[model samples]
Target: MRRTKVDRRVKLHRELAEFIDMDLKMRGASVILCEIYGKWKGLREKEKDHEVVWPPMVIIMNTKLDKDDNDKWLGMGNPELLEYFNEYPAIGAHHSYGPQGHHGISVLIFESSTTGYFEAEGLG
Candidate 1:
C-alpha cells in the first residue's frame, strides 16, 4: 500500500507526541493536552511575486504544572529537547503561562520543507 501525505503526517504526529510524553515524564511533569498542527506563512519578496511557506509543525503542550513551576523549568532549559530540535529542521520552542498561573503551554515549532496550507490537529 502506498502511503499518502495524511498517513505520513499522522505518523509524525504520533511520534512527536510519544517523544514529548517521554520527555515530560522524565521531567516529572504531566501532560494535560498535546496538539500537533500546521499553519501557512506568507513571504513577500522584492520581486513582485508572493510566496507561501509551510511554517512549522507546531506542537502545543499544556502541562499540569503551574506558571511558577513552568517558568522555573523553562528557565533551567531542556538540553535534550534542544538537541532534538537541533537534530530536526526546526525553529524553536516557546513557553507561555496561563492567565491564572494554574497551567502552562509550551509551543514547539519544527520547520517543514514543504509549502502549502494545512489545518491544525489536536493529539490530546
Candidate 2:
C-alpha cells in the first residue's frame, strides 16, 4: 500500500518528534518544540545562503541550544530510522544578541517532515 504525500509527512513528523524527545531527555537537556514551518530555513543562514539548502521542513525550538548540543542530538539519530522517514539530518543554530547574553542555539534538521511537537521535563 502506498501513502499519500500528507500521510507520509504526518508519519515522518510523528517519528521525528518521538526521536527528539527521547534523545533530548537522555542528554539531560530540556527542550520544547515551539513551532514548525515550511517556508523558512533556520535563523542562522548567511545572507547569500538564504536559498533553501534542504527541504522546506523547519523545526523551531522553544529552548536555547548550542552547536555541541545539536551535534549530540544529531549523533543520536539512527540510520534505520532516518531511512524509514526518507530524511537526511541537518543541524542548524540560531544567532541572536542580547544584553543578558548571546543566543546561539543549535537544532536538528530533516529533509522531509512537517509539524512541530515538543516535550520537556525540567529546564533551567
Candidate 3:
C-alpha cells in the first residue's frame, strides 16, 4: 500500500510523542497532551542564508519548561532517532494558564533560524 501524507504525519507524531514521553518520564514529568501539527515552511523564507530548513512543530504539555529544559529535551534524543529528522529542531517553551483553572505550557519546536524572533516575542 502507498503511504499518504496523513500516514507520514501520523507516524512522525507518534515517534516524537513517544520520545518526548520517555524523556519527560525520566525527569519525573508526565505528559498530559502531545500534539503534532502539519509541516510549516514559513521560516525558510525568513532565513535565506541556511541551506537546510527545518519544519516548525508545536507540542503542548502539562508541565512548564525553560530554555535549559528545552535544550536537554533535544539533547537527550539518540542520534538514530535524531537522524530521522535529518536536522535539529529548535525547541522553545511558553507558559500559559488556560481557562477554568487549567495550567500547562505550549512548546514550539521550530527552526534555529527563527530563534531570535521567538525569543524576543517570549515564545521561546
Candidate 4:
C-alpha cells in the first residue's frame, strides 16, 4: 500500500510536468513542480493532533510579461480565469508576482482542500 501511494505520487508528478510542458511550449513558459509538506495546526484543541501534511501539487510558472502592465500580466481582473482555478480544488489561491529584478511574471498554482484554516493549510 505504501509503495502504491509512492507510485501514484510519482505518476502524478510526471503527468503534471508533461501537461505543463505541452501547454506552455508555444508560449515559452517554464514550470517548476514542488511540494510543500508540514505539520498540521488545527483550529480547535480536539483537532490539534500533530500530523504530517502535504498541501498540494504546486506549479510555479515563469512567463514573460511587460513591466509596464503588471495588472494585465497578473490577470488581476479576470473573473473567468479565477473561476476556472477555483473549480479544480476544494480550496485554492492564485497570484502573480515579479518582473521585479530578475524574474518574469510568476504564476503560482496549487491544489487545496480545507475544513477550516488548518485543514486548508494541510491540503491534500
Q: Give the better candidate number (1 or 2) by lDDT.
A: 1
| For model 3, the run of ten residues with the poorest summed lDDT | 72-81
Error of 2 at 38 (Å): 12
Per-residue alpha-carbon lDDT of candidate 2 for residues 26-67, written as tens digits (9 for 90 to 100): 666554544322223443455644444333333333333334
Cα lDDT tens digits, model 1, 83-106, are 644534345666664455423455
Give RMSD (Å) of candidate 3 vs. truth.
18.5
Poorest lDDT segment (10 consecutive residues) of candidate 4: 31-40
Q: Candidate 4 regions off by >4 Å?
A: 1-53, 60-65, 69-81, 84-87, 94-124
Q: Model 4 has how many clashing residue pairs?
A: 0
In model 3, pairs of residues that clash are none
TM-score of each: 0.30, 0.28, 0.27, 0.26
Report, for every candidate in turn, its global Cα lDDT versus the true structure: 0.44, 0.39, 0.42, 0.42
| Candidate 4 per-residue lDDT over residues 15-74, each given as its tens digit | 855754464454454523232112323423476456534444333345433444434343
Question: What's the residue-level lDDT of 109 in candidate 1?
Answer: 57
Cα error, candidate 4, residue 85 (Å): 3.0
Pairs of colliding residues, candidate 2 = 65-106
Model 4 per-residue lDDT at 76: 37
Off by over 4 Å in 3: 1-3, 34-124
